[model samples]
Target: MANDFDTIKKNANSFIIEIHKFIRENFQVSIGDQKKYLDSVTKDSVKTGQAKLGSFIISVSDVLLDSMIIIVYTFLFLIYKEHFKLFLAKLIKKENHPALMDILSQIKVSINNYIVSLIIEMIVVAVLTSLGLWIIGIKYFILLGLITGILNLIPYIGITIAGIITVLASLTGSGEISVILGILIVNIIVQFIDNNLLVPLIINSKVEINAFVSIMGIIVGGAAAGISGMFLAIPLLAILKIIFDRIESLEPWGYLMGNHVPRKFAWRVRRTKTQE
Candidate 1:
């Protein structure tokens, strides 16, 4: 019995030692592998961050340069406005000068009206947005509303970005799903009213552009010159429409771009009657 007990004690001690030995061997290898992985990840993250920073700096520099150029050109144009008119007059016949001047005046008035209407729309949108956010108990509602108003100038994508920003801001505070939902609902309702009512009454009335042309212009402008292009698209299209309408050969194109919708079969019946 003594001999059997001794053998059992020796076997149990050996089993424990073997388990400890196995753990010790594997633990060192696991720790070394984990350290290597962490080091690699840290190095990669630093490289990626540096690349992003460099790209961001370059973009900001380009934007600043563009802004400075635009400011300089605006100042020059304001200072030499009559000189530009004279140059345009010189490009055409003397008899056509009056017509050309009339076109220029029309263009100036249209652009002014469009800009003023946009400002009014912005103010309206800002007030509505602030009121909505305030009602939802959102933090920094005024600032967010102002941002939404500014972004709203960018056309279709602007409102979407505003919604995302508002949702994110709400998340930072309460982080509640209900707050996020409330923010979204408010934005949607405001956007709906702005699009259906305010835009038609204010912007569309001034610009006289069809929805299809406006959307296409924004898309093409965005693809060509980014955000600035999108913002300028409507005014530019309006200007083009004015020019096209003045030119006899291009009147059809001006009509095509305009918001005027005729009866479905009116044109066809008119053509048949003319033939008869």
Candidate 2:
């Protein structure tokens, strides 16, 4: 019995030592391989980051160059505004000069009003969105609201993007589902007010564009030039509408783009003898 006990003790000790040896050997090998992998990853990441930064710099430079060119062109146009007006007048007969002048004046007024109204709309949206987000306990509510207001200028797509950003920003805070829901509700309410009240009174009244045409224009513009195209679509359409309405030959096309409902489809209450 004593011999058996001694043999069992020796076997147990050997097993423990073997395990310790195995762990020591494999641990060193694992650490070496891991270090190599980390080094490789670091080198690759640096190269990738450099490439990304280079691309970003090129894109920014191009944008800046284009913006500068536009500013220069605008300055030149302002300096020689009367010359351009005379140039346009020269294109038509002297008899049509007054009409052309009238058209140009209308265009100027429409464009100016549209721009002013747009700024007002942006301010209203930003304030309302910020207030709602703040009330809901969202962090960075002001920044998010400002972003939303700017993006809202893009028509249907802008508000959707703003909502997505607001929700994501909310996630960084409480990350609660209720908070997400609150964000959605706020966006919906704001959009409702903007579309129904603000747009009708401020923008649509000045532009006089129908919803169908506006939506189609936005879609086509987005497809052609992405976000910039979408942003310019409405104003361009409005301008086209103005031109079309002024020209006798293009009146029908202008009517097609306008929000005027035909008399046949108009709702009216017939007068009854008692009511009369």
Candidate 3:
């Protein structure tokens, strides 16, 4: 746990430092570009700069405000969680109340275990990534590794962003396209190992939620709640499945939420039936 925490802290520091470095480098480059653009433009330079600044401020504020609201809501929900459970119980029929409580308990347990497993997996990924990048003598390996590990939390989208950022950082640091390709190869190898070995042993065994369901949940979540929704979706679906599986009428929906067999296996079964 201490080691995990250290890795997170170290990675975070690296991430921030690399961001600062990138910004500094770009700012230096953009200075000449901006001068050329402003000189070429007919509009008043000061006014244009002010307008751009205003727009940037507004966009940043909107993001910050939304994030703060989410944090506050989450805090309040945690504080009143027990009361919320009681509130839920009161809404249901007395006969169904026990079953509801049972379902909720299962949901809580499943989510908790899944979260723990994810954290462990992330720690392992971060450590290995940092080590690998360090071995290859990448300048911002810590930052890239940290970003890669953290982004893996979001289904489908996160790793792609990680790859782009890491590759760009490599390009900036080394000025070599070969380094970028190397990073891609390392990323693919790490991702392959993670998906096949680490995920099955850690996340898949515990979550039992298939990739299709998880991806759909992530998309739906993003549509409904933006980034937070994507983070919340899988757990929400997992909880829904627990409830659906428990209720007599909802068994079919629970199965729908469950993992599907491999396509090859399904095809084989279908062929056997056709032969029969």
Candidate 4:
């Protein structure tokens, strides 16, 4: 853990150094003879360089604080969990208690299934990606694959970012354009398999929402709260869908949000003569 932290810290500092150098190197040639503009950009660049160490310190502090808060909250939630269920039950009338229980149960099962599927999918993707890249002779394949797999959790956007990064890594490692193209092709194939086979079998089975709606939710979440929001949008939508489906007036909303398809229509399954 300590070694990993040191590696990350070294990489972070190197990244900042490279950014500063790039800015300093390019600003003179890229811009015209606008003295005021150049001066402002230079000042900002200097400020950024100066703040690099401070920013790293702040990030570490934030991680520690967040971990501490999560530990405290987890302990509290575990201790008072029954109380929470009681509080939820009391929110509705006694006559509606059973329906409320069913709704909450649905939410619990769906979310738990979704979370488990995600962890499993991420592990598979990471392992496969790393092994594939290694076989293809890419440097630092393990690190790249791990990054790609984690990013892949963010849905559509993650794969795009991973593709770009993989291509860049390939180009840098091999200095051959062929390597870049190979990486892109490999990534595309992997993603196709993930989308059609793994994801449908795992995640989509649990949280069946409309693709267009899911994309829009991710966009809205990204706009509202950045990466974390985008990462959480689908699962949150699934939970909301369960609640919406249970409430009489909100059933229409849930229906609109879902895939509205039968499970037999799975991509991998062929239409038999009887079905046809």
RMSD of each: 17.0, 16.6, 9.0, 7.7
In terms of lDDT, which candidate is stronger, 1 or 3? 1
Clashes of 1: 0
TM-score (all chains, Cα) for each model: 0.67, 0.64, 0.64, 0.61
| Winning model by lDDT | 1
Model 3 lDDT, full chain set: 0.74
lDDT of 4 by residue, 182-204 (tens): 67777877788787777767776
- Once fitted onto the true fold, the runs of candidate 3 whose alpha carbons sit more than 4 angstroms away are 1-70, 155-157, 164-173, 194-201, 260-276
TM-score of 3: 0.64
In order, what lDDT does every prediction score?
0.79, 0.78, 0.74, 0.74
Candidates sorted on lDDT, descending: 1, 2, 3, 4
TM-score for candidate 2: 0.64
Q: Which candidate leads the pack in TM-score?
A: 1
Task: Put down candidate 2 lDDT per residue, 106-191, tens digits, no spaces.
Answer: 87888788889899999999999999999999878999999999878766656876887776566555544567779999999999
Candidate 2 vs candidate 3: the lDDT winner is 2
Please say which candidate is ahead in lDDT: 1 or 4: 1
User: Ten residues in a row with the worst lDDT in model 1?
Assistant: 1-10
